[model samples]
Target: MKPELENIPLVKNEEKKRFEIELNSHFAFIDYKETSQQISLIHTEAEPELAGTGAAAAVVEKSLIYIEESGKKLLPFCPYVFAYIKKNPEWKRIVDQRFEGYDKL
Candidate 1:
């Protein structure tokens, strides 16, 4: 069964450069690097048991929302994140043009 995204609390762990969400007794997270101009999402993973439950997507979505609110362009370097944005083109608005190639990945 899919988890309720609204119930997951996404946390931005700046010191670790990742956004995390606790789920099903495990943690899902998206690693990123931020600069004044952009925030690059580099990796994303969910605990093995959380697979297929939308935990990864929940964290990624929340991270994107945070990046949007912060007004920084997004650089989706992680394959998963790139694929996510490609499917959710509305997020293209916040993506950095330099990494637009991610759409093709």
Candidate 2:
């Protein structure tokens, strides 16, 4: 059986500027940089063991939720995050307006 999303604990490591979740013994993380009004998602990675486990999406979802709750705009420079937002347009409301029409890129 697959693990429930709630079972995974996503943590924001402010000192590392990343959101992290543990899978097995490895860590999956989404790297980001924050300013007063915006947060730029720069990268995302998960251990090979976590592939196909939905761990990446879980972390991204949790991170985006946090950003929304914090009232910060998101700049998804990371391809994975960009793609995720594209697929989940409801989350686009929190995206930086400067990135409007980014799909054309």
Best by TM-score: 1
List runs of model 2 lying over 4 Å from the truth.
Answer: 1-3, 100-105
lDDT of 1 by residue, 42-81 (tens): 9999999987788888888899998999999999989888
**lDDT, residue 13, model 1:** 90
lDDT of 2 by residue, 23-50 (tens): 7888889999999999989999988998
Candidate 1 versus truth, CA RMSD in Å, comes to 2.1
Query: How many clashing residue pairs appear in each of the predictions shown?
Result: 0, 0
Q: Candidate 2 deviates by what RMSD?
A: 2.4
